[model samples]
Target: MLRALVIVPTYDERENVPIVVARALAATPDDVHLLIVDDASPDGTGELADGFAATEPRVHVLHRAAKEGLGPAYLAGFAWGLERGYEAIVEMDADGSHHPEDLPRLLGQLTDHDLALGSRWVAGGRVENWPRRRVLLSRGGNWYTRLALGIDIRDATGGFRAFRAEALRRIHLGDVASHGYCFQVDLVWRALQAGLTVIEVPIVFTERVHGVSKMDGAIVAESLRLVAWWGLRRRLRAAFELVVHRRRLRSVRANSSRVV
Candidate 1:
């Protein structure tokens, strides 16, 4: 049996942790384990997770000293799973935006692809309870990200995803720099660059009903800036490589002409 770990990062999500954890465990296969990565949520989210872990053998918790951001929390969770010999690692949101019932579908797709992304913009995918402006922003942001990064994924910023351990290893998780929502986009980009196959699974995204949203203007701006910077860097590196290749070809032809 391939062992899988569903990593849920939480911060001040005291009200929703138990429900999400229960649903995730119920939806996953027997081999799938759940790990709650809590950033020392002052709301006692960590305590709630520990309570669950005490009774459930499949559930575990990693309590961080402080809120270091989503990226770091996930990194820590991934490392925890990797060290424990899990073959697949899943990324899920604790606020219930990502449905645990869809976990089986996402993990099933991982059999043929290196990554399975639960996307809201794909066919049969939809969002529930989000206002028009929020929907438009998500759509436009994904469009912009695709244009900038040249990735064909419909929901590059979606948080629900499953990754094969080998694929994650290939991407070198330690070098990931995004500490916000852009972290999703960064991982997708790196996985593609490493020549891994990525597939999207349609999923319904729901607005959180229990707690405050973590999204902020600063996080959005940071995502935009990082995407633009990465795009520029990719272009510059390609241009430099082209120049170098042309020079080498010209030098080779010149030598051939002298020999002739």
Candidate 2:
């Protein structure tokens, strides 16, 4: 049996933490463990996670000093899981947008692929309780990401994802600097760049019933800026390589003519 660790990052999630923990534990096998990465939320979310950890052997908590963004929280969680020798590491949201029931399906995909993403933009995937404007925003962002990065993934921004430990090792987690939703895209891009196989599994993403959304204008602007920069850098590298290839071909032709 593959040993897996599900890393859930939490911040002020007092109302929803227990629900997530219970459902996640019930939904997966005994070998699957839960690590709640709490960002020292003022509402005592960390204390709640500690209570669960005490009673449940599979449940553990890592308390940070402050509320860093989602990216740092996940990065820390990944390090914890990797150091502990888990064969698989999973990223999940604490507010219940990512269904614990779907964990089995995501874990099953690791048998063949390096990464499995719970994608809302893929065929057969859908979101519940989201407004039309939110849907459009998600779709548009995904579309733009695909076009800019020239990748085939349907939902690069989705937070529900599973990673093979080997894949995470290859991804060079030290280089990842983006935060918020952009962190998701950054990982997918890095995985592809590392030649790792990635697959999207259809999932029903439900809006959180408790807690306000963490999304803000700043995060969105950062995502857009980083995506565009990466795209531009890729295009420039491709053009430079093309120029070098053409120059080499011309030199070869000239040398052959002289020899003739």
Candidate 3:
């Protein structure tokens, strides 16, 4: 069995953390371990995680000083797993939106692809208990992201994914800047840029039943701003490359004329 570590980041998810951790442990193979990275939840989520880590050998906890952001928390987890020599690292939500049962399918796909994305927008993929407005918003956001980034991935914002350590290392996690849900988009874009093979597996995303959601208006705004900025930068880089190529062609022609 391949050695894998599932990194679940939590913030005030005291109610959901234990259930998610248990499910992840039961659902995955024996070789797969779970790491809970808690951002000093005032609700004592870190304490709860510590209790689990005490008895469960496969379980571990990393406590941060305060709520930093999803991106930083995951980066910290990834670094820890890499240092420990885990071959595969997984990203999962502390909330139940991402089912642990689907982990095997996602990790299995890593045999051929460097990244296996548990996509909620692909064929056979669906979401439960989501209102029509929320569904529309998610679909529209993914469409906009696909167009802006010029990536063919169907679910750019989905958080559930499995990454081969080799591919994750190539992405240079230090350079990642997104701190909100857009962190998913940023990493996928980076993987594509690094020439990593990315494949999506369909999965159902269910809304969380416990704890308050972390999404806010500011996070949404940040995602939009970053996506637009990246799109513009890509366009500008392309245009500059075109100009350089044209200049090189002109110089080559001038030299040919002189030789003639």
Which candidate number maximizes TM-score?
2
Q: Global lDDT for candidate 2?
A: 0.95
Q: Global lDDT of each model?
A: 0.93, 0.95, 0.93
* Superposed model 2: Cα runs more than 4 Å off: none
Clashing pairs in 2: none
For candidate 2, the per-residue lDDT at 83 reads: 98
lDDT of 3 at 209: 98
Best by lDDT: 2
Candidate 1 ranges beyond 4 A from true positions: none
Show pairs that collide, candidate 3: none
User: Model 3, which residues run further than 4 Å from truth?
Assistant: none
Give the lDDT of residue 142 in candidate 2: 94
Residues 1-260, model 2: lDDT tens digits: 37999999999999999999999999999999999999999999999999999999999999999988999999999999999999999999999999999999999999999999999988989999999999998999999999999999989999999999999999999989998889999999999999999999999999999999999999999899999999999899999999999999999999999999
Which residue window of length 10 is worst by lDDT in model 1? 1-10
Worst 10 residues of 2 by lDDT: 1-10
TM-score of model number 1: 0.97
- Per-model TM-score versus the true fold: 0.97, 0.99, 0.98
In candidate 1, what are the lDDT values of residues 95-214, reduced to their tens digit?
999999998899898889999999999999999999999999899999998988777989999999999999999999989989999999999999999999999999999999999999
Superposed on all Cα atoms, model 3 deviates from the true structure by an RMSD in Å of: 0.9
